[model samples]
Target: MICDRFYFESIDSLHVKINKLIESVAIIAIKMQNDLRQTSM
Candidate 1:
């Protein structure tokens, strides 16, 4: 039972880390789009 709980906890933390990485990637993509528009103008 203890091992199962620990395994679940690890998966939860990994999920959180993936979410953070995705957020940062989204922010970077938006910034790049804005920059592209400015340069095109």
Candidate 2:
């Protein structure tokens, strides 16, 4: 039982980290797109 709980906790933390990474990547993509548009104009 203790092992199962630890396994789930690890998975949860991994999920959180992945979510944060994706969010940062998305923000960077948006910023790059905006910069390109400004330069093209």
| Counted clashes in each candidate structure | 0, 0
In model 2, the runs with Cα more than 4 Å from the true position are none
What tens-digit string does per-residue lDDT give for candidate 2 at 1-41? Answer: 99999999999999999999999999999999999999999
In candidate 1 the C-alpha lDDT for residue 39 amounts to 100
The residue-level lDDT of candidate 2 at 5 comes to: 100
- Global Cα RMSD, each model: 0.4, 0.4
Q: What tens-digit string does per-residue lDDT give for candidate 1 at 1-41? A: 99999999999999999999999999999999999999999
